[model samples]
Target: MCYLYNVESQNTKGPGHSRSLEVPPVRVLLFILATFLGFVLLELWLYWQSKDKPLQLGLWDLIFWGLLIFWSVRVEVRLPLNAGMSQLFLFALALVVLTPPWVAPLAAFLAQWGGSAWYKEFFNRSQDGLATAIAALVWILAQENPLYLGRWDLSDGVGIAAAAFSFFAVNSSLVAFVIHLDSQTPLREIWRRNMGWVALSYILLSPLALLLARAYETPLLGGWGGWTVLFFLIPLYYSRFYWDEKVRLEEAFDTTLELLMNALEAKDPMTRLHSERVADIARDLARKVKDGDEAYAQAIYRAARLHDIGKIAIPEAVLLKPGTLTPEEFALIQSHTTKGAELLSPARKVAFDQLVYNVILHHHERWDGRGYPKRLAGHEIPEEARIVGLADAYEAMTAGRPYRKAKTPEEALREVQELSGHQFDPRLVEAFTELWEQNPIWRDRHAYLAAKEGSVSRSTSPQRSSASASPSPSEPGPRTSEE
Candidate 1:
């Protein structure tokens, strides 16, 4: 998998890229602006083209649009890819099969425009209008007039399927285009990541669109397909409610983990920000490793932040000791891993996976056969553990410790590079180095602090010497020169 770090796109910067709704880039705004004008032009052209058509618009089609407007405006289920899922599609098909191809998309645009304006969402009105116009235009290309075939059969159903799919495809493409412009995410990535399952949803739901078109088109059904949708509509509204509850539940889990982290932080005042920095590094590393999403990286980050929760079981005397730990005290401190895992044991009842527990328990393990608790060797430790372990070491080195003052970020990175294949995963070290180079905060912290303190700048070069007895970071290893 090609990670963004290796892609060399200056805009594909690392983790702390905030997406909190500030004013978007001018380019994104301009793109949306251009789309809105295109939609207006398309609507006018479609109107002019349909003005002289032999076919006349029907009352049932307008009724179907009203039903669509009511059901669609009531609820929208959020998705990772596009904005939301709603039931405007059922009528979109009705327009293609029973009325002019342009009607559904145009009606949907008008309904959405009115609704969004009432809700004071001027921006969404623009998005709705453009997206609908695209869907309408594509549907028109597929069907010059409504399919007037009588006595439905497999071939007839296939035409319905094809027409509906075309509209959905064009609609999704428009939405994806805007998302690409707004997020600066790669267009291909957005389609693969966000639109893959969306296509599936459209496929699965196309039959309902077909059914609605059939019910309304056949005079025997009395145009009650609009009311028939109530069955699915009720469940869809409830689904949105259920999804909201699930979101709250996920937030509650995060808050509980944060509380545990806070309790652990109470034991070591100096290391309060330690877990957060490690989480930041671990998140970036996880994203590089899997080509995973920002959300997945954040999950790793949340898990990393809780890696030290077991330390809450340790007494302050050993945990906060001003000097190096004695053998027994160190062993006791090490037991916090097992203790931390035990503390989190009950969370399994609620479906918490072993990944977080593995990270907490084995983050201290080494790449070589020499680590604590289980004494596991390379690849024996969980991948999450190896990642958090490296992040912990870097943070521990850069962060001032009870035993010694903090090393510069440069020294910490050198220590990380040297430990690869000895204490840390060599691959993860390489990944970390890639991320570290991208984010400036990791390198700038110490220098800015020194400047503010009016102290002479300490050399951040890798040649610094420390002779601590601990096997960690004191003696640089053979692979120190690799990168």
Candidate 2:
């Protein structure tokens, strides 16, 4: 009983408190080591696949990376200084100067100078550079924190996790920003493509850094090295996806524009065959003038297809009249050029807007200053548009209409050559004649039309249908070589 009493006194807290604690640091270290090895192997495999080609860095690329890094470091260093609005003013000024040198100079200048003017003129009358400076200061302060030290801490397990997350955040942000700026791609698209890279890099590199930190007891090595690897990986990942998407989207846009042109042909049944013939002739002429110039070929095709879109506004009575139009009717018909310009203006917001808009607006302008609308002449008419105009005239003259008999191929060519300087661009006419002479199909179509003079039906006149009419010769009766 006495021994029991003594033992109870020793355990005065009312319990047997004699348990040993196990830290298990070695087990944690081993786990981290294993994770690091796995990640290294995966990264090696990915790098081997992607590193087949040599890295050719451009001047602009170097400039952009240098500026980004500089800005990042500056933010890191000045965060704790409490420099207020002055710091922000300096940052904005630096951006204004540096951005133009890397991005488009004209775009940067307009955004900087014109944007400031617009803001002052419209939104805030009293706001000045100081106000902008203050706003920038607020933004910098929000992003800065002393504990961050421009790097993540990975001494403890929690710190390792934090470091991994930060690596992803920083690298992903940089990649997305660069892609958006360089490719002129949408922000959402950049994010969609780059997010996977961020994830993969984190999965592969974070564990390795954590293991190295634990093994070496130098946490900075793992944290900093992991971030560097992520930085390089981000751009690599984006390059693969960006180029793939760019090519696909470009091809899709080209196809869509071509289909739209074809639709324009379908709108007018009578003009469908004529448009095709003109497009062929115009394309040939364009090749002669500017051989292998894709821009010229595309412009010719677009202009020829839309040359008669203005005719949509013309009345059926005037379009299909068996005889010549009255002075007022002819004037109304001439208004098609302006109407076409108006119709195509809305579509100018698309990808090849400038080229398409030029064709739609200026195809009717003649070599001389006597053309309608703007009366632009010679080189001002646009070379491709001039080619289309010439081809259109040649096709219209050779193709019989209800009002007039089709001319012989020789007569049409002679007429086109005669009115070269007055009605069309002389150089374009010369190119067109050369192309027409070389193509036998064109010669045969014209010969066939010339022989079937007065063969087109004037009974079912254009005044009957407000919509387009079909130009099939066999629908009513078979057409002979001569009517």
Candidate 3:
């Protein structure tokens, strides 16, 4: 296979023009033939590995291959065959000449469709494309340099440049074709996101090609390097894209939920900050009770935030009532829970939607089964709903409404504790009491203010002393019996 001995030595002195020895046409043909056979074998091995599941060749596949062949043919026809062209030209020409017309189309189709599908499932197309392009370029460059090619002959670098350029050009072009066939996502965006993987492909594969060229004492064609690069880079690119898309999707969902929350708050001004405050408190308590399970705590928080989402269906007049509600008005207010469940049920994709829906629908449920909508008792109520219930009561007591003064944090805690096992879960109440004890002074001040407003007077003693141990000025001097 060594043709170097037959070629005239450049150092030899000759009177006439030196004639270069040429390999027999048959030898060159055989070398070309063997390279393709090698490629076929490698492809067969790959096919076998993935053979259990047959690859689906669909309409998109046809389009992808068709575009690839068209471009590859165009590039082949356009290649300048001047002396400056590297040996890569000969190699590429031989391969193209040897390949059946149908092969290029098939390869093109597979590259395009397979690449696109892979990107959609697991990779960033642009990144993968970039890496592949870079790898192809480097491979082309290595092939053109006689020193690098191990042929001990100087050849122009044009072949390497052309090979690199054409390979990446074809790959990226195929990618674009696949993008067009896939979805409405802008091709440019897909390209941008996957470009890194493309660059990485080149970075990883070029060295392998160089090593193969050295080992075989021939150009690196029909080797495992290309397929290996694809196997590794494709999945890597896919994973990056998958993760990025997942995060973006999550953010979008979160933004939508926030918008919904805002709309709900807008509909009932009295509950403007109520849900948010309750969510914060519930999340805090859930963290304690759930043993630092952040996910569970988050679920509780979201449930609390959306606990009154059903109240959007309630009339504004009833929700913002400044005076005592009639029995009929109270009954109307009770309908918000079921309405909230109904509203959230349609938004099933929302994170923790079920938990939020349950909290919204059952936050009013008493531990004794006296709660509205569904009179679910004790453990029958979801834990998230239970947490939201405590948060709701705490926020209601500590925040002033039109008909009531804000209860002190301490008074709120006391009321919740009193209602444990009757209105609130006993375990939740214990957690609330622990939280309140951490800030006694703030709690007492709010309790005094709540008592002064006469909002909680029906529940708490009107003559109770202030935290200062002094009788409240607002206390009536004495109760007057009929004189």
Candidate 4:
């Protein structure tokens, strides 16, 4: 199986769908038990069938391929989010192709014995072993006997391809499902975002396993295919470099965006962790509103975080004004929406998605069509913008400016409810109400900060931790801070 493991990071770009990747301990344990038990049952059944009719099994071949797979398992390449990929599947699948149904999965189970924590290692071994068992069954169904140079024809190639595809499908689904359970991300979305490209690679590279099996069968290379198998190392080593560069580039992009966010916060201290709080709320609401579209949920999350990017360009004088703003000053403040959109436009093709641009430009727009910039109202405003707008208002109301007293959580909830149809999508307001009832840490600023502090001190899952932490949101600052 092509194993994927989560690597925790602050950036939300990769596969770790949410800030907290916690799953119900019971569910995870049940899944591991089920998977491991299923593999054992299959192995026992396969062994029973083999006993009835003796089949050629190569112990030396098993040792050689198991060691190769172990080596591959040790060198995993990181992917975005908490996921990773490695060449473990290549040799493991090759072992499935060349050996009997019972042998390869056992070898795979043993090969994955001690890499990660005990629970993680057990889960990996179980899933990989189960996937190998299923793929080995597919190979047996396609071609009754193991492949040799004599049997290596076009039809056998089709069987190998089918087996390879089955392996990928089973393996990725198992991993994706676990991630889905852990992060509450949609299962289909997980596969679409993470496993789509890897599927193609599985099919394209399956031929190499066939060649390996054939090489072992051939007398031209002396003993087994061990000598030629060594050649796979060069290409595998180089492939790691490719994935490394890709991950580096992604990290660089994330870092650059963070720097921009940092600069925005420095210019407007009021919005320090304000964006992160709003983003957390927006993402939660987005999942409720657009549960089927993972991309939209993720986009709204990103857009909420940068919704105030335009505020960076606003003059500090007007931004810091304590008294009611003059018409001209208010206008200047509103133009931050357009300015932010323009500033981010250059990166649209490269980094920012259209939904992100929409939220940055239109987050302040009111549902009643009275808001600024485009003044797009109702459904005319992008749904992404509407979601962010509602979240931003809630966050800003609770995280009051230095000149204004911050509203209590109950007061903020009432205000949000009162403004429902007039300032927010009624459906979204309903969704937010439900989320509020759930009492997510972000629903209350004080609780959010407490949880953050606790998470830092106790190393717990700080689901509500924003992009950055600072003094309390309600505390006064150097200037009159406005949302």
Candidate 5:
């Protein structure tokens, strides 16, 4: 289940595919209920803070709120951020600066209504108003009379930045959490993938939002005089367009890669979805090994997936062969590592990473120096390749192959343990061994369910060493897992 930018929708319960994925009913209700409670609490706090002043709505305020509702609904982008992007923050900042504390949440609700209708999603509205209200409350609490925001002084930079930071930080965290709940993906991965890159975007845009708010009040350039603010605003829209295009291009790339995976599977049924499973497993292994380097973990996942993509160039006869291959045939098959590296070299134009290439070329190399075109050993092999190397082997062992029956998870784990420090990096083996204990059936369960209860039972079996290499397309190297 490889996820695209939209994240994987394994159990899509939306009315139709036209709508983006939604939070489950239970979570949505919980989130909405929490928002309502928070809204009530903030209102009470603002009332006390404002010396018991009643929240009043005047016609002029209504006019401004209407403009906010309009822009927030119409202007939006899908940046690297998981949440849908909206310049609504611009007007929310304005409301906080120009109006009293209680008005911000009221305006947020009205503004979110417009966006809800535009997106036609109830869950979207939940997060939309929820974040703005929180941001408004933060601004109110910060300045008591954040009315100073009307001044837009560089002297108050610390306070202004604090409110602005709270707004985005709370909003991004809330949205990322919802995404994690909906997707059942790890929360850390979700944050790194969706929220990490958006931080700079938010930083660059926050001051502009405040600037626009301040400019709107100046008699010389405000709307009351003329549309002078448009001069500063048109560029932000352009930037939004640029970011939107970037997201679209990324989607296109993911779709293209998915299509390639489909083609690879079609060419050889033995490999059908094998890479995806390996990718999932490899990612988990990478997390255990590195703990926090998400980008590197993703690279390892992609590398594991494409480790055998070079097989695309090998003759189908050799790929699908059901018996032991001759020496020449084995050698031809082994060339896939180099061939894959060559095939992917052009991706540099698209900013494809060097680690992907390294993993593809070196995944077959053993830790003990007995493997591959380079015969690289131990620390000489890239750690990324080592991670995928163990993952690839695990997948091959647990899965049934054309040449031999699948080993149970226990058997596979035992074999991997035996190969530690020889076929696999000792450190990675320790990491994977932990995962094997935590969840031997992490990928799929059929094998583990039927596997012998203990590794000791499988110790006497004949191991697939050099002579058994290249038994079939399924088992194609001295190390079947790397193959």
Candidate 6:
């Protein structure tokens, strides 16, 4: 799908292009300013057109519906990365269907009266007003006077669906576009993680807006249409609670994984940021291998972060030893793969998918069946496991321990290339070689750390050296290159 952002590629040859999607702070601010001005112009034009036309809704009618929509916005549920969702769209769509074409944008603009940042509040107003205005136009083309309809037919249902899709398309694209510009995240990934699940609520819930409008147009139980709108709140409030529960569950799972990662970090100080680096590389590689499957790439990233979680159960003596391990000590190190899997088995039923268990258990397995607990060879090993294994090996080599000095990025890349088809998947090895040539921030440990800590200078060239080094025969660690 096409995204609403700019992507510039580096003038270099590689398996993937180096995309520069990051926008400057000043540019983002200017974009927000432009959006606000555009909204003002559109609202003014819409008002001017409607000034001479007779309006159907009275002042009290607009006030009543606007108040309901404002209250809906007040209870918006907060999401990650300073985003939020609410059922305000339900009332907004209903307003579009029930009122004149010009009324929807005005109600939407006035609903953004209170928020944290003045600029952000105004931007939200602009985007919402624009989306509603577009939806109102769609409704006008389909049904000239929806307020006067007696009974609905299939064509009327189609009209409502089309209008709902138009609103969501414009609204979601604008919000996702700003986030894409600011954070350099892929638009597909952002939508998958944040907006994909809520899409059904936006589209499938369109019919409810029709019900809301009908209830308002034809009062029941001898009550006013305003009273019927108030009663419609019961089901909408429950639906809002369902969304809240989903977000809460996701947050709880994230917190649990973080706690486990912290415990593992405490036991092995050498692996302080090792998992994070591996995860970053693994995610990029997975995206390339899977042909830009954002959801699968995200799963690979999460599983990579916890691939070595089993090491936490190992004794500190074995974990922190600075010398070569004895035969028995090495056996204990090998057991960490199974130990990690068993430790997280309970979570498998909760939030952990089968992919996570596979990574924890089989990342140590080799393509030639020469490594690890199961000795699974070739395609027998899960693809996720192979991807994480290669990433783990690369990170372990580059990140030095107390006994072994760290390999330079050039040395590590050479070693990885040399081991292809033996300890690593040859296909993945080629992918990684191409990725390294692109000079991503995660190519160097220091670069990755600098980027993580918010430093802008992260340029590094791939060092081309003829020196070839073999993988260490007995580096002896829980998650070393040799394994």
Query: lDDT: which candidate is best?
Result: 6
Cα lDDT tens digits, model 5, 89-203, are 6666666666666666566655544323222244444444555656666665565443344657443345456666777776666666666655566677767755665667766
Write down the TM-score of every candidate.
Answer: 0.74, 0.43, 0.47, 0.74, 0.82, 0.86
Which number leads on TM-score? 6
Report the C-alpha lDDT of model 2 over 281-328, residue by residue, as the tens digit: 776677678965545665677566666666666677776555545667
Kindly give the stretch of ten consecutive residues in candidate 1 with the minimal lDDT sum.
1-10
Q: How well is each residue in 73-156 modelled by candidate 1, as lDDT tens digits?
A: 545554443344455665556565666545655666666522221212333444454445555555555454444457533544
Residue-level lDDT tens digits of model 4 in 140-172:
777765456685555578777887888788788
Clashing pairs in 5: 393-481
Q: Give the per-residue lDDT digits (tens) of candidate 3, residues 38-153.
A: 34454454345434643433555334334533332222211111000011212222222223222322242233222112223122222222323333334434454545357644
Off by over 4 Å in 4: 4-38, 52-60, 79-83, 112-115, 118-123, 144-242, 437-439, 455-483
> Candidate 5 regions off by >4 Å?
1-24, 51-65, 78-83, 114-130, 141-155, 181-183, 222-226, 349-351, 440-479
**Looking at candidate 6, what is the lDDT of residue 304?**
90
Candidate 3 residue spans exceeding 4 A from truth? 1-227, 349-352, 439-483
Worst 10 residues of 2 by lDDT: 1-10
Q: What total of clashing residue pairs does each candidate reach?
A: 0, 0, 35, 4, 1, 1
Minimum summed lDDT over a 10-residue window in model 4 is located at: 472-481
On lDDT, who's better, 2 or 5? 5
What are the lDDT figures for the candidates, one per model? 0.62, 0.45, 0.49, 0.72, 0.65, 0.75
